[model samples]
Target chain A: MSVTVPSGFRASGVVANLKSTGKPDLALVQNLGPRHSAAAVFTGNRAKANPIIWSERVIADGVVSAIILNSGGANCFTGSFGFQTTHQTAEAVADALGVSAGDVLVCSTGLIGVGDQEFRDKIINNVPAAVEALSEDDDSAQLAILTTDSVAKTATYAGDGWSIGAMAKGAGMLAPGLATMLVVITTDADLSSVELNHALREATRLSFDRLDSDGCMSTNDQVTLMASGASEVIPVLADFIEALKSVCSDLARQLQGDAEGSSHDIDIEVIHAKDEHDAEVVGRSVARNNLFKAAIYGNDPNWGRVLAAIGTTDATFDPYAVDVSMNGVRVCHAGEPDQPREMVDLTPRHVSVLIDLKSGDATATIRTNDLTKEYVHENSAYSS
Target chain B: MSVTVPSGFRASGVVANLKSTGKPDLALVQNLGPRHSAAAVFTGNRAKANPIIWSERVIADGVVSAIILNSGGANCFTGSFGFQTTHQTAEAVADALGVSAGDVLVCSTGLIGVGDQEFRDKIINNVPAAVEALSEDDDSAQLAILTTDSVAKTATYAGDGWSIGAMAKGAGMLAPGLATMLVVITTDADLSSVELNHALREATRLSFDRLDSDGCMSTNDQVTLMASGASEVIPVLADFIEALKSVCSDLARQLQGDAEGSSHDIDIEVIHAKDEHDAEVVGRSVARNNLFKAAIYGNDPNWGRVLAAIGTTDATFDPYAVDVSMNGVRVCHAGEPDQPREMVDLTPRHVSVLIDLKSGDATATIRTNDLTKEYVHENSAYSS
Candidate 1:
């Protein structure tokens, strides 16, 4: 429903022993087109994975012919050997797809630290099978990229003469050093790689970058955008950018809703700040506050926890002049108690927290999730 | 035996119906001093609690005759009436102890935002009774200042001429905006307010400020040191500072050990950093990482989570040249896998992690607790 939604993309997922569970772990996306202009973004983390290091250089020329993905081994911090493995995997995919090795992007997720020899063997042996099975079906690619996510995430934004479609996979480690996810977006909107980069950056700034789930930054986060220009119909760049942003936003929301073991999806709308940076600083401080997140899970409209988080930031705000609202209830007005907390209902899965810093008119929003027992349980038992 | 471990200190605790548990919640500490010199540090948060605001002003005079503490409500964001409650509590303590009102300090800890009128009424009615029960009983005062802690924490350090003793209480909100603790330290070493301030600052900098469990800075954290000068025993100022630091470090460890719902007490010893600040930044980054904490909870030596967290910091280090050791087993050597993870054992509640940044000679240690289901359960079900 994603890559194929654009005119010239084929994808497939293949089962490989790369995953101990023997689930589908290899995915291939081939862009067949008159123009294969592409743009990509990688994790902000300084400790990058092997595939990330490889793909960063591949996307430098703004051209990508095919992309390869695997789950179950991060291939991060595995020294030079892991880097070689990533390079070889891309080479194998390039050979099978009849594309240049330099234009093949690779992404891998799952366990961090070591890339097991057995997993590498499986990936090497299975790359050709994934390539051979590639079809116009995007579902397999979407499924293969997931780690702990419970559902496949795909979104489409249609325009007059073109469309933007994307598939994303993420569950835990959802903080803004790109939130531990692999994403592939496809569009046939007759745009150059520079335009694709501009639109991708702008959309992600307001989407995936603002979604902070558990405050853990991964080393393997990557988002790739491939434009085939197969529609041969050009639309206004501004409108196309808007459509691209909608798709990114939709996928970001889906990731938030499916965050590992979370019960409530939270959107913090920070308003009236000195500047956009101040607004984001305040919002992220709140988003990373485990106490505030736990309180939300309890259905407790604990605005003072919000205040405590606000105080931790250098954001421009008078502590006593701020106001906080949970849902539609003004639990705190001007930093003091206002409506009763009981007036706010938190039985639903979606929670909205509004903080008015009352310093300036600037605003920003951050998406997060309520920390729950299941979250701790899942994370604690995961490694075991 | 906290306050009275030093000379010229009398303390008492009484039930004030402040906490719903109806346990001891009010405490008074009086100094029978030849010189009433004191030093204090308050939470760095901009959202100051009522008691924190009052105590900051009182400590500026460098004299404090007594301190009043309660552990039911934080008196934060509770409007003008909450400020009045703090003022009235301090006045009551001063009146009962026959000291100047300006020389009395107050501290409160519990739920934030709403300070019930009934809680104020009970505190006002019970202050005189606590004063009447005053004795050289540091044990009672220690118990009165705890909220969710499983035990009252106390530490004593003996010097050649005098001794230093302290009591502290903290559970959640254990990030270092001075670590969300209400602490009162007493010493009989004859020193000026300036000297006491210098010693206190130095001691807390390496001790209390290094403990970061949940990364949530609190609004009501306060640490105060009162010198009665009754012993008139002046050792070298440096030796006195060392004794004070020992007491602070001991109490800080006890706080970490008794942190609510903690299954493991972790000491992240960061070595060979660019500076002490870099060491601390790197250590706290690892300490606050929930994924790493959860991995420890499961007894899984997931060194990659540690690397992922370390990569988030700006500490000077070669990303590929760092080493991480868990429980004396170097699982990650120079950012690559070293010992088999199964060689490390995390069965003990006390876990030590050594990270060698390999940048410089400076080092620091951060104290934390593993994220566990019990923590999430306690925090989630706490409000009711």
Candidate 2:
């Protein structure tokens, strides 16, 4: 029970034959609510997919009755015909659920530029079947949205008489401002759309926004939150925000653990910076450095590469006054070798790199994965 | 006859036992000139090598009498002792050539943090042998300054009455603002240091500055030009600049061809941008995109990745109006799939990606290579 874990929500997953493997490839989630409040965030990439464009319009009015998502084709760079297909899918969902078409959202993921007439017909024909299969405690919706992911990611937060349930799917192309993930969250809290939007932005900024795996932004990424007044619990705004942040961060770590062909989950933390932005900039610079990532894959504590990477950023810091530590061992002190690199064990799957700028009091962390031969192989053979 | 192809230059390569392979690892070049005028550039990375820090002071007076370069150990992050080692090496060269230590520039390349007492002793002990072996026509200096490179890189430009000769060594870490390369250029033309500086800056800006094989910048990168005025004939400044540009561009291509663990040399050209900077920003974004690079490695014309890459930049362009062509096939036209991707051929060692930003009339090109599994292997096994 992922999206349907919350009360007043029904979800179903069905096989639409969008994938050649005959796996479940379509999902539908409906809100049987006294209040139809919703908020969403799309990919920051300018070249958005057709479904993303349609969903942005549906979410503008802060009311969503249902959402229909598909796997197999991203429906991006497919021109006006693809946009028509997304619109038709939403209209089908509205007709089946007896809701306004303007209040239905659409999402798609997989290969780009693959939307055709057959793709449109398969989704439109399955709407009725998906609506009939909806249940109050179904976990199939979590399985229908994965493309390259090895597992389903779901997180739940039980508050005071209120709960939030979320499911996310992504395996690669994870970077800042969100990855190639499609997420849907449902809550039984008595909250308005405006309040939900405020909480979601702050939550995602500290969670998904710090994950820079591979540093590749996607063209089709969406995270949505829907609220139903079933619980009638008017919780404190601060408490709600903290709960939401916890769920998002949990899902983000799950995504990192399942990233495509990755061997190590590395956390690059920057401390003693001029500000939060400076610390983030410094951490992101190291996170995106391919040479440094490859070194981590080889289990080499190459602190010099870290220095070289951070040197490229405009963040305020003295290159010679910085310190670097791996795990719990300080490898570099004041930009010189301290502990022997052999003392730092990197055989574990989790690696932590600590960088002290020795400037101020701000700090941040960026999560990334190592570069490996398997990573090159997976991406090289992805389309072929 | 690389750097010695021009007049008034004597160079030699000697064994210093710095490398485990028992190969020549030290090189010395002297400007036995009537007039010594030099111009040089170092890496823009803030975490510079100790040699770079010392050489910067030597080139400040626009006069350089000699330059010594070594391979097998980059004198970086070795503490103040590393700076002392660099200074001692320059002093050794100055004493041998009967010049001021301030007139000698030094360069080193290899694994960072490897300069120990033994490393310094080996270099200092071999200075006398290197000086005694110097000759005007020897090419040993070209062979000595190589780490992971498979071939010696040399380029020559013969003007009406004067000529320019240059040699460079770098196989990885090639990026904008120069790579991990150490270059030495010699000319017999009659020119002042001010004139040489102007021409060298312009030449490098259009040549090596556009070669971004990987997005990694190095802490030890330098390019130096020394004019001897041996020909005693002054040429037009514009003609000299054009000749230098040609030589630098030729050498840059050679570096791209020999880039470590690369199979295909890719050239991403952005056309009709708002300005040159925008064109460069757009081209470099695609050049550094690992997804696009891996797609090219698989010989797949995935144009959607190209659109997604350029969309990440702040360049002036409408994503919907862009066109992407691989080789001669326009795979994506006006943001929609036009020609099929199967029509494009990528079997050759060279691949071209053309992006038409239909926003203005400016254009730029960036050179890069495909991301391969061998790259991971080479870098992982390095510094071991």
Candidate 3:
């Protein structure tokens, strides 16, 4: 059997027993590279996980060699002890890979504030084993980084001379401005961190930051892009940026597809806004609307819920100057119901809402999913 | 049956067929005056409803003789047609009650942007009939203002020499800064509009604004306070304010309890915040969290969801310095898990969460409810 691989990246997955279930819960991905320029984004959440704090500092140097991620426990709110656990995990990975400890990034997602010494010890002892197990054909590493996700998500785009490959994991605690999503992208493009960082931020603003399935921001959300510079063909940076965005957007859509208890994926497009910022504000406001999400779940195209959501934002616009279209059918015009309610079709697996602000040319697109009973059942039944 | 009548007020409910369902859906309340001072609060939503726009302007004089409320059609976003409908409704009510048109306030809720000339004609033609049915003993008036509510909500409180009575109707489109809630309060205490307005704003800031069951603000939300001064008891203005707050709080709780499709009512209490504003911000963020609401639905005492919700707010404090308690059991303290997960009891009709900000002596309380399948079904299936 052939093992799947990402460009310029080597990966490994192992059972570190961090999870009592003894499931595969630990992963390691190394940028085996000539140039190690890197760009990363962390959760905007104020109550950030310990590993997020560690990785944020590590990526400041514009380079990283490896990332160690665990799925069983998010080392968050564990105080000083939790920070030590993150440090020890990174140190272990750094030592095993013969790299600087400061160059190794760490991420954890699962239960918060449960980082005991025993968990740290098991992680430390397993690092060498994980390093030894590293191979070019280890797709299982991507699978290991999932907590409640039903499946692993990976996207790869091959360009003329360079390739971008990425994997993401998240099922809930998903919202705009960065969800609980974790993504690692590896590419062989010869790009500097300055350009990489700028491109990554722009890509994220339209991709991960636009997905607001559950309207919750996780404490351990992180996205890192590593350039291995392994490819000799130097593609145009503009093309590379587009490729990066494609991967992130694909992963973000996958995250929404796997949203806990979700019945349908909904896309909200805010067009003719004052600017991108206003479009985002309006898009996010609609994406986080519970009534709107629920209406989609029931396959009901309730545009009134859409108007109510938009009314809450500070985005400058006359409510009466807007038009709402669902699934290509204009249901509302100038803030009033313009079409027969029965004309809208919302029972499909996917739904789209287009809100024409009629004030400017700016637009934004947000993706989310409907809330369902299964989401409640899964989160409530899970002890963590 | 004898209605739960509030002192110093007359009420009536009529069937005007504003809703396509042909249900009884218009209500009128008059402060049969010994004094006519009044105060009102409208939705903060920039896209104000037509009736809200009318009432906000009419009540500026601090004197109101009557209030006419209609359900089944929110005269919002109907453009100039909506403005005409609202105007005609107030005029008809004023004519029927023999009061100045400027002194009669109007409120409409339910479907938005569907009120046409025909609907206005039906309402205008029925005003005299509704007036003839007016009675202090009719509780059906409260029922008539409902759109999707499963039960009518009304509250009354008696002071030493004065009394306060209130009614509210809403189901979905509920969120912070005010939901779709429409509240009407009648008081027999003598007070100025200046004093009443100040008290109404302060009371609502802590009451209706704190309830965020669905996180969608309605265009038609309005809270009106009318004083009849029937008791001729002019207590200290501060006492009157306190009594009003008590009434608003009670009505807010009732609204949460009857939140559409809700199975559990959650009260999140934030303590030791930098001030009441910060506490309210923190509390409202949690109340608006879909994941947290789902966890409560599944009966899972997941505090991580709570932490994630609070992290999104700009409220001042260290996430690590926060403590969370669910139903009297400290589930998390100082940013770490403090007790066994099993120790918390979340399977109650009412759930309480106490968050200690540890920043100041200020505190605030927010009321909300768990998201359930029925809520989704109701909102989604209603139109279709």
- Report, for every candidate in turn, its global Cα lDDT versus the true structure: 0.86, 0.88, 0.81
Show where candidate 3 strays beyond 4 Å: A1-8, A19-22, A172-179, B1-8, B19-23, B171-179
Alpha-carbon runs more than 4 Å astray in model 1: A172-179, B172-180
TM-score of every model versus the real structure: 0.98, 0.98, 0.95
TM-score of 3: 0.95
RMSD of 2: 1.4
Q: How far in Å is the alpha carbon of B71 misplaced in model 1? A: 1.1
Candidate 1 chain A lDDT trough over 10 residues, lowest sum: A171-180
Prediction 1 global C-alpha lDDT: 0.86
Answer with 1 or 3, whichever has the higher TM-score. 1
Error of 2 at A216 (Å): 0.7
Write model 2 residue lDDT over B1-384, tens digit each, in one string: 988888989999999988888888899889888879999988888889899999999999999999999999988888899999999999999998899999999999987778889999999999999999999997889888888888999999899999999999985433442236888999989999999999999988888888888788888989899999998978899999999999989988998899878999999999999999999999998988888888888888989889988988889998888999999899998888989889999989999999999999999999989988988787777862
- Cα misplacement distance, residue A217 of candidate 3 (Å): 0.6
**What is each model's TM-score for chain A?**
0.97, 0.98, 0.95
Docking class of 1: high
Q: After superposition on all CA atoms, what RMSD does each candidate show versus the true structure?
A: 1.6, 1.4, 2.4
lDDT of 3 by residue, A274-336 (tens): 999999899888888777777788777878778878988999788888999999999899887
**Cα deviation in Å at residue A64, candidate 3?**
1.5
